[model samples]
Target: MNRKTLALSAVIGLLAPVLAGCGGSDGGSGGEAIVVGTTDQYIATDEAIAPLDPAAAYDTGSWNVLRQTIQTLMHVPRGGGKPIPDAASKCAFTDRANESYRCTLREGLKFAGGDPITADDVKYSFERVLKINDPSGVAGLLTNIDTMESDGAREIVFHLKTPDATFPYKLSTPPAGIVSKKDYEPTKLRKGFDVSGSGPYTFKAEVKGDTVTKATFTKNADYTGELNVQNNKVELQPFTDADEMGKALDSGDIDVMTRAMTPEQVESMVEKPKEGIQLTEMPGLEIRYLGFDTDAPTVKEKAVRQAMAYTIDRGDLVTKVYGSVAEPLYSLIPSSIATHTNSFFNKYGDRNLTKAADLLQTAGIATPVKLSLNYTTDHYGEATAKEFETLKDQLNSSKLFEVSIKGTEWKSFRPNQIKGDYSVYGMGWFPDFPDPDSYIAPFLDKDNFLNTPYNNAKLRGELIPQSRREADRSAATNTFSQIQDIVADDVPVLPLWQGKQYVASRDDIAGVEWAVNSSAELLLWELRRGPGAS
Candidate 1:
């Protein structure tokens, strides 16, 4: 990374208080140890990882855990860099056009059942995904793929219909995970007990929502370090709440805890050291925002939307609700990354309730330009209600508008936001892929999941596709910066803050440190029960 990139990392370091000196206890108390806790329950989201076939995969919280068990064709590291091979042994570009590509497979690789890994499996993964055409289908990744054929028993070549420079990086995403061709048949799907894959770890059992899911890794005796990180074994247990996760970690019931602990939780843990708890920090790609549904009649008026944007006190929200663990965001792109520009903050800084009222008055907003605010009840935390409550107070007290807040579970909150259900809502995005494109395309792209029936001719016509179509991404930086400014002026989806990825692990569990991308997916190989642990 250049100085600019390094400086960005430093800024993130200054902003990350979520996991700074975080820990509640040490590991190992002898009673069925190695439990893990999360904020959400596992819902059927991934077809490969979901309980049944015929379902599609989307980047949901529930699917995150499952994707870890299944290996993707490639994975992007935390810091800014190229994609690394995860499933395939070696992938290369065949045509100079950056369209056609071929990937060589690793020899002697076996699934949990010892099925030989082949190039056909790689071909089937994406083709089958397009065949199902799941509503949230990741077909966008394969836009240039005309056909995928095996060059040899161990090699696969993807012939593209157009020049697609991003194909290599796109293949690295989880949606592009290699599936077993034998397991996946034309007439049926593989979603049930046939959950098998060739990874460093094997899924022994998955006890749905309870405290039991064991993935045993016997060092892959046949493996010669295709997977850089390898562990003796892995044990996973899921807990639903932060309090439960924290208590479990505190009492040495589990090896690690996450998302469950709030900013205050870290502070408390840091202040009073517990037995086996030790906290460390890593960078992450998580971004949280307060989305404004422009489809709402009231918000369609730029003045009202601008006022709503201006009225929000992002700093106070960060300090009060997030316990200073989050940093204020000005655009959809996060500050830690290069594509980010503080356009929103530059335009709308320091919640100015007085100016917000003036803007509403100048726009001649009539009595009760009422707005329906929505949020996910269980996803963020107990304080989520209070955050929106604060939003309601600021806007209502500004006399610009009246706000009514409602809460729903995440499962509902996701689909509704894509459908533009409420006037405004609070939702966060953990990048499906690490690229800046991940953030911009998902929300602003007209064809994306957040359908956003938006007609931003400028963004759609120029900024996005232009960048993706070109071979050199840096050439499009100016266009993206322009997009940021346009997005700031439009105020359709207002980004509130970006939170650092955090983990509250036992002090004994060594090597459980943070990643730059702050990838929450715990690599068993990177984690070992330390001398302090057992």
Candidate 2:
């Protein structure tokens, strides 16, 4: 069995914890409010705008909060599947080509603040995303939308610029979250931590300076949606690091832990089970990757990038650094997604010193290619620094590269990445939705999310658009394979490892597995106290 399978198989016997620990505190009318601790900080700065506003929020950190507070027309179901109705009563593509889609608002839906939700609000919410077009926002995802029209208060229709089969999946994301037209302005972002939506929860955050220290979610009495809210309230606390978050869980300061926990912490929990803690493992779509600034001086040459790809050993990094918590990824499209290809492995196989030397020698580049690798310090996890050090050792051992490592916090690192300041940098990706297009389009397209100067004409201009034309996604496998093959040849980005999602929580808390979705958004309503608590 593979590492992921073993992790899941071992979980069956190890999850038996019987302890009457301190249950959640009473949440007035909503009953006991379950508290969840997370290391995923809600970041907003002059450099990168946090997803406090649905129009400006794009990253997973912001989406986690938005998914709970803001109601989208549709949402992905729990335990992994396609999206179903949430706010909308029914929705379907009006045209056979997938160019036109329509949704009918569910009856009697209203925002948390007592404003009625309507089709006009949905239209305004999407239009603002296109109008503001924040550099850090998810505006790129809405480019296909040519025009949207709302007929009265109950119905809305979308006309797409192209036949995009992935449009529904995009609707299931945080960017598509329906906002109150009354509360949010048309041209600018709606600032502050207060959220007004028609989802299952009404959110209020405690902000110290710019960071959100704590947030509370009260069950929305006005909510009319598919989710069956089990609890009256839920509290969220954001920690700066995983260790601090784990400590909070252990001390009963928090009831559940999600988003991230270091490999060492997970291994320790498995080897010696803690008294009241239960670890639940789920399939993760998050992938760590290295992106290069092709215009930069050091790694501008394609051969230099190719040589580095051949030298680094993903197995060694997973074994030594991650310790069976992660699996080696050879494709930009992870194994969890459909039509994934192992083009990188097929071309380069495992690490080969001879291949690295020949690529450099043929290009007339001298030995020991000097490189400075950049990474974000606080964003990914605690294991990142160690992961880079292991990479440095692997490249140096090949005798064809000399490397130096630098770490910057996410706020500073993001702007520098946008400006192409670093020759090579590391970043992690969590899919906006569960689709192969989400993996390919954001990196390979002309207007890429990375803002790096590595857009390939064939992949961007031809393959991507062709694949989108197919209404049945499985029919686009050949096009996806070709795209992956070209990506392997170009060597612009290198896939490192794919992570396995884990949620460690107190045994008293139920629905740990269902708390987080396949897209990595935390569903606060899924969490509830187990039977016989308090």
Report the lDDT tens digits of candidate 2 across residue range 414-497. Answer: 788878889999999988877778888888785577876887888878899999887667778899999999988888999999
Cα lDDT tens digits, model 1, 394-458, are: 77776667789999976567667766677777877766654567777777765465556556888
Model 1, residue 381: displacement in angstroms? 3.0
**Residues forming the 10-long window of minimal summed lDDT in candidate 2:** 1-10
- Give the Cα-based TM-score of candidate 1 against the true structure: 0.85
How many steric clashes does model 1 contain?
14
Task: Give the candidate number with the greatest lDDT.
Answer: 2
Candidate 2: RMSD to truth: 4.5
Q: Stretches of candidate 1 above 4 Å error?
A: 1-33, 44-55, 77-80, 144-146, 159-165, 185-194, 204-225, 353-355, 358-364, 469-473, 514-517, 532-534
Query: All candidates: CA RMSD in angstroms?
Result: 4.2, 4.5
